[model samples]
Target: MEPGAETLYAYANRRRREITEGVNGGSGRIVPVTIAAGTFPFPIDATTRNAIASAATATTLAGGDAYTVPSWLLPTGRFITLDATAIVVVALAISVAFQAVFSAQAAAFAGIADGSVTTHEAVDAILGS
Candidate 1:
């Protein structure tokens, strides 16, 4: 099994539970689950790919009313549709760096403000801090 398969399975199971339990005011509609197995490399063996696709379709048909997982939960589809994966990754990296930098700055400022160190001393402490 692939790394994402478990997550997908859990997502489907959660949706199944939600549908059966009537989380949305007792709708009582059976939600269908579709699990499409996809290989890592593009253009996989035709037969296997077709079989997986067929299984996914059959699963959808077997369950009366189909309810798909939200876009964010589907890795490939969500990333491709939004085209924001790179942007999000960059943003998160910058955010983490900024937090680290600011935290160090704050620590230096605190030391200076509390009279634990002079401006020059704080600058040296900050460099070493």
Candidate 2:
């Protein structure tokens, strides 16, 4: 996991570069794909295909808190809250901070706020082969 915001920023930038600007002098090539989802025919465009492929790695980063990013991003301790209602609020804030920071970096890399990389279920749905 990334030890801090700087490392996380670097990793996301690297991932974006690898996908968008590879060795071929900037003119990106389309990968041929055939998708059969069900009785209905599914034809995925290049942007969608790229997003779907990237989602595999992206979702892992998305679930940063569950995957233990809080260890690196936040202070170590059990979250304490006297108010019962505020307990969920406090916990969600800490976890969501870890998630939102990483995901926001991804959005900036892609030049849009369209990352569908939220959970493992999302990746499975988008990238199941």
Candidate 3:
């Protein structure tokens, strides 16, 4: 039988704490992804997050349809070039993934509070695959 939501909540909470502490199940905070330009190891540290936000805003303000992230911005020393349409698609995908996780986390919390949690469904539902 699958573990209950309470157990899943505990596991998720611990993982979240570990990620905050830069452990992340020994993978650390870097989230590596492959775009058309190349692979980018996106660090989730505060500094990098801030930089990404600033860069995203700058891209919007620059009024350009295309944005080319320089190689230096990537941990793998590769570039990421995306036009506005592609950027939107990528951003939507990311947003959807985050929404799923957050929704699951919230559902777990609510289940814990109300004693309504049942069996586990799938990894993709509770957490992104």
Q: How many residue pairs clash in each candidate?
A: 0, 0, 0
Clashing residue pairs found in predicted model 2: none
Give me the runs in candidate 1 sitting further than 4 Å from their true place.
1-83, 119-121, 124-129
A best-first ranking of the candidates according to their lDDT comes to 3, 1, 2
Pairs of colliding residues, candidate 3: none
Candidate 1, RMSD to the unseen true structure = 21.6
lDDT of 2 by residue, 9-108 (tens): 4555554343333334432222322222111111132343343334433434555323221221111223221222222233333334334434645454
What's the C-alpha lDDT at position 39 in model 1? 21
lDDT at 93 for candidate 1?
Answer: 38
TM-score pick, better of 1 and 3: 3
- Runs in model 3 deviating more than 4 A are 1-12, 17-48, 72-92, 116-129
* CA RMSD of each candidate after superposition: 21.6, 21.3, 5.3
Best by lDDT: 3
Please give the CA lDDT of all the candidate structures: 0.35, 0.33, 0.52
What would the per-residue lDDT of candidate 3 be over residues 1-129, giving only the tens digit for each residue? Answer: 767666767766654444432463343245555556554566554455555555566668777565644433455655566555445444444444444455666766666567655544432244433
The positional error of residue 116 in candidate 1, measured at the CA in angstroms, is 2.5
